[model samples]
Target: MTKVWEASVRATHSFLSETSIQKIKISLPKILQQIPDLIIVEDEKIIAFMGISHQELEMLFVAPEFRGLGLGKQLINYAIKNFDVNKLTVNEQNPQAIGFYEYLGFETYRRTETDDAGNPYPILYMKRKEN
Candidate 1:
């Protein structure tokens, strides 16, 4: 969603180009359909959602007004607790997200390419090992 970017620090970063934003918006709904397990966070006036697939995670979004309140961590931890496998991909250039994933004990497993709109984007594969 463009609105999500409008409220996110990542939006201001060079990695969030029009192409990337458009690709994310277009792909999110389809991804959600395939991964119906969703966790949502609601504050006074803001709501965010994160979707969990078989072993993958995606579509993590917090409303602009509700950023920086540890909602992301809560949502992610919820997924970790509920799912057997924990994996996510962050764009290579999105350092903030990469660092956040690392803080949550996700380690980079590989660098890969995603076919988004017939173009390739670099993504870092991160996984949290099971205990």
Candidate 2:
């Protein structure tokens, strides 16, 4: 999880300080504990994973090497169809992620200056468009 974060989310998040990164690392265990459902794809080791609650996608991370192989999309599709999730938040700094979600038919409906934990990172609240 940490590795994937570094390669995907962290790499593009140039605004994050080392302190902020450390904070995320420290909080991961607690975050995982709070998630109700987690799905993982692995070959030799974990290549990707998605965490969810009743109707929200909590997390989705695909290892850098496995990206562009549609793992994230597959996980999201599974979440929407199986878990009934239709909304999620993404860091506004991650344009690639924003584009990916947009391609998946999600649209940003809200924006905030800080994240759910009050971090300085901006957040974009998105919901799937009804088709």
TM-score of each: 0.77, 0.92
Give per-residue CA lDDT, model 1, range 1-131, as digits (tens): 33553456354346667766666667656766776677756555436777777868865777756767898888888887777548997777778778888998899999877634444658888899655
The true-versus-predicted C-alpha distance at residue 109 of model 2, in Å, is: 1.0
Report the poorest 10 consecutive residues by lDDT, candidate 2. 2-11
Q: Write the per-residue lDDT of candidate 2 for residues 28-105, one digit (tens) a residue.
A: 878888999989887887778889987888888888788898889999999999999999998998888899999999
- In Å, residue 123's CA in model 1 sits off its true spot by 0.3
Q: List per-prediction Cα lDDT, in the order shown.
A: 0.71, 0.85
Find the number of clashing residue pairs for candidate 1.
Answer: 0
Q: How many backbone clashes are present in model 2?
A: 0
Best by lDDT: 2
Error of 1 at 14 (Å): 3.2
Highest-scoring model, TM-score: 2
For candidate 1, the per-residue lDDT at 102 reads 91
| Candidate 1 Cα misplacement greater than 4 A, ranges | 9-13, 23-27, 44-46, 114-118, 129-131
Could you tally the backbone clashes for each prediction?
0, 0
For residue 117, give model 2's deviation from the true position in Å.
1.5
